[model samples]
Target: MAEAAWGNGELARAVNRTGTETGQRLKYDASAVSHWLSGTSPAAKALPVVLETLARRLKRPITAFEAGFREMPTPVDKSTDTVSGLIDLGSLDMDPSRRGILTAGLYSVALTIPGWPDVVGRFERLRTDPHLRIGMAEVRAVAAMTERISTLVDQFGGRMARPMAASFLVNTIVPYLRANADEDARKAMLSAAADHCYLTGYMAADERHDSLAQRYYLKALELAGHAGDHLMYCTTLRGMSVQAVNLGHGSTALRFAEAASSASPQAGPRMRAFLTGQQAHALAQTGDKAGALLHLRTAEVAMDQAESKAKAGGRYDPSSLAYHVAQVNYELGDREGAIRAIQHSEKVRPMVYRGTRVRHRSMLAEWQIEAGRLEEAVQNWHLALDDYLAIQSGRADDRFRSMLSATRPHRRNPHVRELLERARPMAGGRGSARTAQGAMT
Candidate 1:
C-alpha cells in the first residue's frame, strides 16, 4: 500500500506531512513501513495517519479492519451495499466493546472521497422491489418521526437519541424501502428514508462516531438521489463538508461545500444562505480570510432575502446562520466577532435546544479564554458545565474536555483549580486532566 501510494522515500514524507497537519511530529521512515508490513502494528496514533494516507491516495474510505489491523465481519449484500453498511455500522456503534473502533482518528479525511456524485447517479437508476406494499402514510410517519427525533437530539444529545434512530432505520425504514409501492409513494418513501438516515448520520457524528456517520451520510445521499430530491442531496453533501471541516481537512471541506452549492443552483434564498455560509467556513479553514469574509457577507445578504420572502414559513433558521458566522469568525481569528455571532445564535436559539445552548456557552467560554479574560472565562465555563452535566452528548463531552485542556495551564489559579476538581468525575471514561496531558504527549 505504501509503495502503491508513494514511490521509494515518498511514503515517509507523506506520513510526515499528515503528522504535521495533525499536530504530531512523527519520524517514521521506510524502516517503519517494512515493520508494518511484517506484522508489527503501528502505534495507535500512527495507525490512523497511515490509514488516512492510504485512503487519501486511494480516494475512498479505509478502515483499520480493511487494513488487516483488526478483524470484523463484512456484510453480504452487494446490491444494497450502502444499506448493509449502515446496518453493520449501527450494530457496531451500539456494541460497547466495538464502539471504540468508530472513534479512531483521521477517518474524516476519507469522508471527502470524490465518488459520491457517481454513487448518487448510479443509485438513481435503481428499481424498487415489487412485492410488499407501502403507502403515503408510512412515508409521512417516517417524516414525522424524523421531526421528533430532531427535537430529541437538540434537547438530550445524540448519545441518548442515536440508538433510537439506528433502530428506526434498521427496523422501520429499511423494511419500507424494500417494500412495493406506487412510483410516487416509493419516491416519497425514499425521501423520508433519506431524511431519517441523514438524521441518524448526524447523531452518529455528534456522538463522535465518524466512521459510522460517514457511511450513514453516504447512504442518505444515495437515497436522496434515488428519490430525485435535489434539496436533500445538497443537504447531505453539506453535512459531509461540515464533518470534513471539523476534522481539519480544509481543501477537501471546501470541495464538498462548493459541490453542495453547485448541486442546487436554483435553491431558495434560505438554502442558498446556508450553503454559502458553509462555503465561508471552508474558506476560513483554508486560510482564505478575504474569501471567508466575502462569503460571510453573501450569507448575511442571502439570509435577509430569505426572511423577506417568507410568505408562510421560513426554510432557514437565523440561529444556524449566526452559528456559521461565529464558526467562520473563530476560524479567521476574530474572537470578538465570534463571540458576537455566538450571542446572536443564542438569542434566536429555541428553548427546546438545550444541547445547542450548552455548546454555545462552551464556545463563548473558549473565546473568553482566548481574549485573556480568565475570571470571565471561568464564570462562563461554570455556566456551561451546569448545562453540560445534564446532556448525554459526546459533542458536549468534547467541549468539556477542551475546557479541561485549555484550563490545565492555569490550574494553579484558585478558580481554574476549582473548576478542574469539579470536572474530574464528569469526564466520564475519557479520564481526567492528567490523562488529557498524557495523550497530548
Candidate 2:
C-alpha cells in the first residue's frame, strides 16, 4: 500500500472494481484493507483481484508472495479440473471489462510442463449434463469454429476475434464437453476442444498475455491427452515453445520444443518441419549457433519433403520456415541475413495473412533502418501501415510503437517525417492494443 501510495479506501475500491469486472461480487472496503494490513489474508478468490489491483497501480506484475500472500505451489497451480478451469478462464477472457487484468499476467519462465504420461488418461470427473448429448456433428462444428478463428487471427489479429473464441468456449464448447456422447464422439470433441484451446492460447500470446496463453496451452495438453491425440499433444507443446521463444525465455522454449519432438513418435514430414523449425528458433535464442543451424537445415529438408507431397493446412510452411530462418539469423547477429530471410517470408506469405504481414514488414523496416538503409525502411514501413490500418492486433500495435520509437531520431528526414505525420492519427485513434489471447489438432 505504501509503495503504491494508496490509502486503505482507495486500495479496497480498486480491488473491488477488479473483482466486479471479473464477475466476483466483492464488497471490500477500508475496514477490510485494515484487516489485511494487520496480517489477515484475503479470501482465496479475492487474492487475484487484490494483486491485480496493485499490479495496475505499480505498472508491474505482482505475485502473491510479493503481495504478502502465500505463493502457489507452482507458477500455475493446477488444482481444478481442466474443463472447469477452461470455463472460468474463458468467462473472464470474454468479459470486456476484465481484459486489462488478464493481459497484465506475467510470463512464467518456470512453468511446470506436464509430460505425456503425466496428462494421458488423467481426466478429472466432469459433471456431465445428463440432458445434453453431442456427436460428430457437434465435434465438426467446434473444429470449424476453431478454423474460422484461426483465419480471423491470420487476417485481422487476435484482439477482435479472441473474445468471440472465449465466448464460444464457455457458451458452447464446455457444454459439449459435458454432453453425453459415444466414445468416438467424445474423443473427437476432446480433440476439437484441444485444438481450440491451442489456438486460443496462441492468440493470447500474440497479444502478449503470456501467462494466460500458458494456461490455455496447458489445458490444450490436458484435453489432447484425454482424447488420446498424441499429435495434438505435441502440437500444443510446440505452441507453448513458440510462446516462450517469442517472449525471450530461451531455455523454456527449447524445453517445450524438444518435449514436443520427443513425444511424437509418429510425426510425419510436415509435423517434423513444424517441430524442428521451432527447435531451430529456440536453439538460436539459447546461443547454440551450430545446433541451431543444424536444426534449421533439418527443418528445411522436412519442409521440402512435406511440400513435395502437396500437403496443406498445417501451420508450418515455406513462409513459416523462412521466418524461423530469419529468427535464427537475427539471434546469431546476422542482421543482413535476417533481413533477407524475413523478406522472403513476406514475399511467399499468403495474402490472407494480413496480420503477419503487418508485423513482419514492420520488423523488416526496423532492420533496414538499423542497417542504414533509411529509404528502403521507409518504404516498407509505409507498406506495413497499409495493412496495419485494417488489423486489431497487439503485436501489430507493438510494431507500430517500435516504428515510432526507432524513427524519432531520423525525424528530420522528409520520408521519416512524412511517415510520422501519416501515423499520427493512427496512434491517436488505435484501440486498446495494450495486450493480450487460439486451434490446431
Candidate 3:
C-alpha cells in the first residue's frame, strides 16, 4: 500500500486548499498515514479517505470500511450514522436556534453513536481517547478564524497562513461535519460547509484565481441549498455576481445581484441595499449610469434603514460596502463620490474579510490617482500596500497584469504603472511564516 499511501497524502493535499483557512486536515507526523498500510484501523469518520485510499491502492472501487480489507474495518451502519443525516436535519430549521443545535466540544467529537452513554464516557475520558472529536465551537470557530485569516491574507497579500487556513477548512470544518452531526445537524452543517466553500472561493478570488473561485462559489451555493439559509445562499450568489463582474460579465453580475435581492425574504433594508449596489455596479459597467445610479440611491436608503435597526446572525456583511460603492462611482466618473465611498468602506472595516482587500484598496487608489489626487493615491496605496503585503507572497497574483492585458486605454497611463509598481512588494512580501522563519535566522 506504499503506492496507496503516497496517493493518500496527495489526495489529502489536493483537498487541503490553501486560499481558504485549513486547520483540521490531520497532519500525522512521519509515517502516520503509513499506519493504514500495516494492520491499523481508522475510527469512524476517517473512512472516507481510508476507503478511497485503499480503493486506489487496490485498483478497485473500495466500499465500506469492513470491505476495506485487512487492517481498517469500518463498523456496520457506522457511515449512515456519522454525519450525513445531521447535515440534512440542521438544514431544515428556519429559526437559527431551532435550526442547528450545537453539540458541546465534548460530544461534538465523541458522540458518534445515538446514545448518551458512549458520548458521556468519551467526554469524561476525552484526554485518554485515541480520537478526539472536533467540538461544535471548533467547527464554529472555523467561521470566525477564516475571517481573521482572510484579513491577514488581504492586508499582506496571500501568505503562509493561506495554506494553514485551507487546512483548517478541510480538516476541521469539512470533516467534522462529514463525521458528526445528525439529520438535524446536517442542515446546519451544510451552512457551515457553505461557509467553508465561500471562504475558499473568496480567498481564491483574492489571489486572482477566478476559476478556483468559481468552483468554490458553486460548491458554496450547493451547500447553502442544503443549509436552507436563503440569505446565506443569496450572499454567496452575490459573491458569484462579484466574480462575474470581475470577469467582465456585467449581465451575469446583474443577474446574480437581482437574484440576491429577489431571493431575499423581506429584502431587508441593508441586504437589499448591498444587492442593489451590486446591481448598480453591473449597470455602470454596461454604461447604464442612470440605472446604476437609481439602484445606488435605493441601496443607500436601504442601508440607512438597516443602520436604524438592531439585529444579528446572517446578514450581508457591510465590509465591502465602500469597496462596492467605490467601484460604481469610479465607473461613473464620479471622482469625489468614489473617493468618499472608499473612505466610507474603511469605516466598516470588516473583521472577517480582511484577508485580501488590498486589491480593492489598490483599485481605489488607482482612481484617486486618476482624479489627479496623486498625493492621496500615494497615501491610499501605503495602506493598500500594507494589506497587499499581508497576503501569502506565492498567492499574491499580479492583478495589474490583467489590467494591462485588457485593451483599456487606462493601462497605458503613468498612474497605472505607478500603481502596479507599488503593488509588487505587497504582492511579493513574505508571509508571516516566512517572516518569522527568516527572523530566526
Candidate 4:
C-alpha cells in the first residue's frame, strides 16, 4: 500500500519532510520503509506523519490502524478533553484495583520524546472561554490545596496522599476550570490545575505507577500550554524525565531534561540547577562519565547562584540537589562518593521530607552492602525498615525488596535470618520470603 503511493526512496523523503514540518527530525530511509512494510512500527512521533504523508499522496486520509499498525485507544483531543480526561484519570487512580490495572499498562518513552517541541508551539494558539466566570480567590484556593498536598506527600509518602490529591482535582478544581471566567482568571485557573496535575503525577511516580505517572504528566503539560505557563511546562517535562530515568530509558530521559532546560532559558537559578542535575544523572546512566561530571559541576554553580539570590525553602530545596548528586555518583560507580552525598542529603533534608529520608537511608544501606560493610548495611537497613513499616510507599517497598535480594546469600546467618523473617510480612502480596528469595535469584 505504501509503495503504491510512492517509490520506496520517495516515501522515505516524504515521511521525513512531514516529520520536519512538525519539528521532528526523522531520518527514514528505503530500508526503513521496507521494515515498515514488514510490520515494524515507526517512531511514535513519526507514525502520524507517515500516515499523513501517505494520505497526501493518495489524496485521502490514512489511518495507522488501517495499515496493520497496533490498535491504540484514540487519544483525547487536547482542545476538549483536557479537563474531563484528567478527572477520569484521577478517579481511576484513586481505585486500588483500577490503579493496579492502569499501572500495568504499557509505557514507552518514545511517545513523550517528540511531543515536547509541539507542546511549546501550541502555547500561542490557546483560546480563552469567556463564559467561564472565575476569580483570584478560587485560583488561590486551588494553589493552596496543591501546596498542602505536596507537603502531605513529602511526609506520608504518596500511597495515601495520591488519592486525596486526585479527588481535589476532580471535585474542586475541574469545576472551577469549567466555570465562566475572563482571560486572566481562566489562565490562572489553568496554571493552578497544571500545578496540581504535576503534583499528582509526581506522587504516582513515587508509588511506582509509571504508566499513570506518564499520563498525568502529559495532561499537566497540556494544561500548562493552555495557561501559557512556560515554567510549569518545564517542570512537568522534568518530572517526565525523572520517571523515564527511573525506568532505565537514559537517552530518552536526557532528551526530556535537555528540552526542559532549553525551553526555559530564562528560568531562575534554582530551576536551572534542578534541571541540570537531572541531566547529569541521565548522562551518567548513558555511560558518559565526563559529560555527567561536567553537568554536575554546572549544577553546583547554579545552586550557589540560587542560594546567593534568595533564602532557602522556596521552589528549589538544597536537599534535592544533594540527592541528585548522590544519584549521579551512584550511577558512575562511585560508592564512597555516593555515600557521602547521601549523608549530606540526610543532614540537610527537612523534617517533613519523611519519605525522601527513608529512601535516602535505604540507598545508603545499599551502598554499604556494595562496599562490603555488612554490619553497617544491616544497621542502616534496620532504620530503613522502621520507616518502611510506618510509611505506605511502593518505592520504599521496592527498595526493601532489593535489600532482601542482596542479603539472601547471608540469610543463613542468625542476624540475617532474623531480619528476613521480620521483612517477610512487609513484602505485601509479593508472597512469602521463599518466593521473594527465588524471584531475586
Candidate 5:
C-alpha cells in the first residue's frame, strides 16, 4: 500500500469497487484496512479481491503469502491422491451453496507446471472397493458419457453442463476409479477418467472459474500419467495453454504451449495442428512475430493434412484454425485481418458449436467496433444476441457486458440505442472483459 501510495480508505474503496465489478458486494473502509494492518485477516472470499486490487495498483502478480495470507496450494502436490482430490473438488463444484467459493479463485500465473516425466507413471495406491469391480465396459461407458457431456457443453454452454459433469464425476466416475479391475481395464478406466476430468476443467475454464479449472487440470494430468495415456496428457497441457492465453497471460501461455508440444514427440497432424495453433497464438501475444508466423503456417499445413475424427483433440478443424488465425492477427495488431479470419471462422463453424458461435460473433462485433465499422458491428452484435440470450455462460456474459460498454458512446445511433435497451435488463451480471485486458500488460 505504501509503495502504491494508497491510503487506507483509498485501498478499501478500490477493493469494494473491484469486488462489485466481479459480482461481490464488499463493504470495506479505512477501519478494515487498519485492522488488516494490525494483523487481522480478511475473509477467504474477500482475500482474492484485496490481492487483486493490490496487484492492479502495483502492476505485478501478488500471491496470498506475499499479502500476509496463507500460501496458495503448491502446484501439483505429489502426495495428494488424485481420486480423493477429484471427489472433494467435484462435490464442492456440484453444490450451489459451495460453488461460489470455487469461482472466487483467481488465476495464478506464478505457479510452476509439472513436467511430463515427473507425472508419467506417478501414482500412489488408493483405496479400492474390493467387492465393486469394473471392466472395459465401464471404461467405455465413462468415455461415452463424457462425449455426450462435451457435445452439450459445446452447444449450450458450461453453465448448465458443468453441474452435470460434477454430479456425474462425483456420483459415477469416482466409484469407477475406486473399483477393482484387471490391469489393462484399470489403465483404460484411468485414461477415460482423465479425459472426463479434462472436459470438466475445460468447462470450468469456459465459465472463467480459473483456479478451480487449474485444480481439475492438475488432477487430469495426474490421472493421465498414472494411466500412461500420453494423448490425454498432452491434450490437457494444451488445454491449460488455451486457458492461460484466453486470460491474456502471454508468457505463461507460451510456456504451457511449448511444454505440451515438447511432450508429444509422435503427434499426428491433427494433434500437431491442435498444439501448434495455440503455440502460434501465444507466440503472437508474447511479441515473437517470427516464431508466431512460422508456427501458424505449420499449423495451417498440418491442419490441411489432418484426418477428420470425432475424438478429442482431433476436433481442431478448419474453423478452429481460422479462429486461431484471428487471435494471432489481433495480437499482432492486424484488426482487419482479424475481423476477416473471425468471419471465415463463423462461416465454417459447425452448427453444434452454438457456444463458440455466440463468442465468435460477439468478438467479431468488438473487432469491427475497434475498426470503426459501427453499422457492421451492430449487425454482428444483433446476431450474437440471437444466441446469447438462450445460453448460460460466463464468457458470453463477459461479451454481453462488453457490448453494453462498447456501444455506450454510440447510443445516439438508433440501432445502438435499441441494442442497449434490449441489454439493459441484463447489465447487472458478473464477468469483466477488463480482466482479459489487464493481463495484456
Candidate 6:
C-alpha cells in the first residue's frame, strides 16, 4: 500500500518539516518507499539525497543502489522521503562567480511583473532577425556592462546589487539571446545572461540561503550548456561543489568536484586548476588527510599554472581566493593558515561585499577558537550569529551548533562561558544581540 499521512495533518506537517530540514520534498505515496525497500531503486538522479534522508530518519547509514537495492528487503513506514528528482547535471560544482543571483532574479521578477510591460518589443523584434548583423562592439559592451553590475553588487549592498544585475540579464543579455539569429552570437549572449544568474546565486550563498543559492547555480549551468561555454559550465559546477562542501554535504560536494575535474580539460587553464582545488577541499572534509594533502599539492600545481598566464580569464575573485584557501586549511586542521587567509581576504575585498565580510569574519573567528584565542572566537561567533539570524540561514544555524560542539571542551572556561551568555537572547523573541546589529534592511 502507498504511504499515507496519519490524522490531523500531522504526517503532512512532518513531511514538510523533514523536507525543509533535509533539503528535499517528501513523496505522498507510501508504497514507493516499499519499492525502495525491496530491490527496486528510486530514480537514479536523486537516489543519493533520498538515501541520506531515510538514513537520517532511521539513524543509520543507507547506501542506495549498493548491492542492487535488494539487501534492504523489509517494508517499513516512510517517515521521511527526500526529493531526488533534481537532475545530477555535471556542472553543479563550479566557481562562486554568480553568488546571490537567483534571490535577485526572483525579487526582480516579483517587482517588475506588477510594474513593467515588455517595453522592448520593437527592439526585440529587430535584434533576433537573421538579416540584422550585430556589431562585435555591442557584444563586448553588453558583457562589460554585466561585469560592472556584478561589481556594483559586490561594492554596494544587495538592495542595489539585485536590481542592477537583474536589469542587465533582462535588458542587454537576454534581449541579445532572444534577438540574435546567428547561432554563435545567440550562444554568446545566452551564456552572458546565464552568468548573471550564476553571480547572483553566489550572492545567495553569501546571504547563507544555500538551497535557494543552489537552484540558481544549476540554472546558470543549464543555460551555459546551451551556449556551449564549456569553461563556464565547468566553473558553475565547481561553484555548486564548493557550496555543497561549505554546507557539510561532503560526499555530494566530492561527486560534483569530480565531475568538474573530468570536465576541466575542455575548460581553460584557470578553471581546470580551480576544479582540482575543489576536490582537495572535499577530501579534506571527508577526513582523508593523506588524500587531502595530495589533492592540495595537486591544487597548488594547478594554481601555479592558472596564475602563470597573468591574463585574467575568469580566475578566482578576491573573496573566492580567501574562501578557497581557508576552506582547505580549515578542513585539514590548519587554523593558522585559515587565519592568514581570512586576514588577506579582509584586506582585498571592498566594502561592496558587506555580507561577504560577515562570513569571512566568521571563518576567521573559527580559526581563533582553534588557535586557542577563545575570547576573540566568542566575539566573532556572536557577530556571525547575529548576521546569520538576520539572513535566516538554517545552514549557518547548523554550523553554529557544530562550532559549539567543537568548542565544548572549553565550555567551563570563563571566556567561553561569558561569550555564550552574552550571545543569548531575552526570551519571548525580544532583545537578541542580533537585534542590536540593527535591522538587516
Tens-place lDDT per residue, model 2, 1-441, is: 899999999999888877754458889999999998788899976787788788767755677888876645337665678888888899999998986667655455656788889888776555988999999999999999999999999988887788999999999999999899998999899999999999999898787667788889989999999998999999999999988787677887998999999999779988999999999999999999999999999999989898888546566889999999999999999999999999999989889999999999999999999999999999999999998878987778888888887887888999998988887767755664322100000
Put down candidate 5 lDDT per residue, 129-188, tens digits, no spaces.
988999999999999999999998988888779999999999999998888888899899
Model 1 local distance difference test score: 0.78
Instruction: Write down the TM-score for model 2.
Output: 0.82
Query: Can you write out model 4's per-residue Cα lDDT over 119-235, one digit (the tens) per residue?
Result: 543533233455656799999999999999998888778777988998898888877877777689879988999999999989888877666788888889988888888889999
What is the lDDT of every predicted structure here? 0.78, 0.86, 0.55, 0.78, 0.85, 0.56
Off by over 4 Å in 4: 1-80, 95-101, 113-132, 429-441
lDDT tens readout by residue for model 1, 158-201: 88888788778777887787787878997898889888888888
Best by TM-score: 5
Ranking by lDDT: 2, 5, 4, 1, 6, 3
Error of 3 at 358 (Å): 3.3
Better of 4 and 5 by TM-score: 5
RMSD of each: 5.2, 8.0, 14.7, 8.8, 5.2, 11.7
Model 2 stretches astray by more than 4 angstroms: 1-79, 310-313, 432-441
Per-residue C-alpha lDDT of model 3 across residues 119-189, encoded as one tens digit per residue: 21121111222344444565467677766765565455543443555556544554555454445554665
The alpha-carbon deviation from the true structure for residue 197 of candidate 3, after best TM-score superposition, in angstroms, is 0.9
Worst 10 residues of 2 by lDDT: 432-441
How well does each candidate superpose onto the true structure, as a TM-score? Answer: 0.82, 0.82, 0.57, 0.78, 0.85, 0.60
Candidate 6 lDDT: 0.56
TM-score, prediction 4 = 0.78
